[model samples]
Target: MTQRQPRRAYDEQGREIPPPTLADLRAEGDRTAFVHCDATGCGHEATISTDQFPAEMPFPDIALPLRCAACGSKEVGVMRDVVGIYARPRERTGWGMT
Candidate 1:
């Protein structure tokens, strides 16, 4: 199968919404969203970075236009990404220390 490239999604208002990428989202402090297949027997999941999708649209509405890429099913579940209250500690390499 050919690799699927990210496609520019559009909002109902005809605005071009850029597809989410983890790096871009993290740099801009944007919230990430997840899309999972809700099909009874389908086990598919994907993570996407987003913030107020399609021109600042809200939840449920933002999820409305999404379709499952795995099973080609419209029965999918969407939710915001969750992060733990505490982040992992980084090692003290002391490389940049003067």
Candidate 2:
């Protein structure tokens, strides 16, 4: 089997930085395994399939947390409430008014 290399975080200079180990990645994955929001202090919970992930993708072991790709913040959350039409009695028209 081929030896897997850890992913590195780089500075503005583009120099090589310390990479995350498989164990580290796994730990992170565990933390966010069920999370689906981008909130401060929130861990990443979703995972991408290895086949779909790029070979050089960082943090291979740890699933990528839901974040704002443009802003790189975990402050993003999935929209769960959706508006839909439903048939109701006229007397109940004001049920969802609030």
Candidate 3:
């Protein structure tokens, strides 16, 4: 893994918003971000909430310690995930049908 750069974060307006800090994430209220593996032949991805991170840290700093679980590579990227964070959970009935 070459430690590729992370993808740019975008907001609902398609505007590349968000400062490179944890405070910005907390202010937005949607603390979700997508973690991606940049290693060859490994495209592992996961949705993580900011709760996993302690306060008083920048967003990009997390990438340094992150690794692709599938390939065990230090090459990974973090992108602010804004789509499903605000989605309403489906209402399931007796049979668990949506």
Candidate 4:
């Protein structure tokens, strides 16, 4: 069977956004993910949120054509938290000084 390719991510007005960077994350209010560039010695990494996308959006389904700022390579990978992290109140004893 053939695999289905994911559609490009769009903005509020339905305009296609490339690479889905920090700007897209802020607009969506989604949690964070690490974007890794696939260029040798490039080591470019970025944390971006996925708020605008559906909750069930797969990692492989993210918008492609991602380019590395360091090496100008077009290969990239996205990594997300396997477990969700929660916030705690300042008054909580578990956390020390603010």
Per-residue lDDT of candidate 2, residues 1-96 (tens digit): 433343344567766666554345444332122224345655443422333334343443334544554446655432211221222343655565
Q: What lDDT tens digits, residue by residue, belong to model 3 across residues 12-71?
A: 666665446777677756577788998888899988777777666778766777878788
Regions of candidate 4 where Cα sits further than 4 Å from its true position: 1-30, 52-56, 82-98
Tens-place lDDT digits, model 4, residues 6-61: 44555677665554444544444437666788777888988655665565545445
Q: List the residue pairs that clash in candidate 1.
A: none
lDDT of 1 by residue, 41-63 (tens): 99688876554465445443445
| Model 3 regions more than 4 Å off | 1-18, 85-98
TM-scores of the models, in the order given: 0.49, 0.23, 0.62, 0.45
Kindly provide the TM-score of model 4 when superposed on the true structure, using C-alpha atoms.
0.45
Instruction: Give me candidate 1's TM-score against the actual structure.
Output: 0.49
lDDT at 30, model 4: 35
- Stretches off by above 4 angstroms in model 2 are 1-17, 20-44, 60-98
Q: 78, model 4: CA deviation in Å?
A: 0.8
Task: Tell me the lDDT of model 4 at 76.
Answer: 81
The CA lDDT at 95 in model 4 is: 62
Question: RMSD, model 1, all Cα superposed?
Answer: 12.9
- Global lDDT scores for all candidate models: 0.57, 0.39, 0.69, 0.57
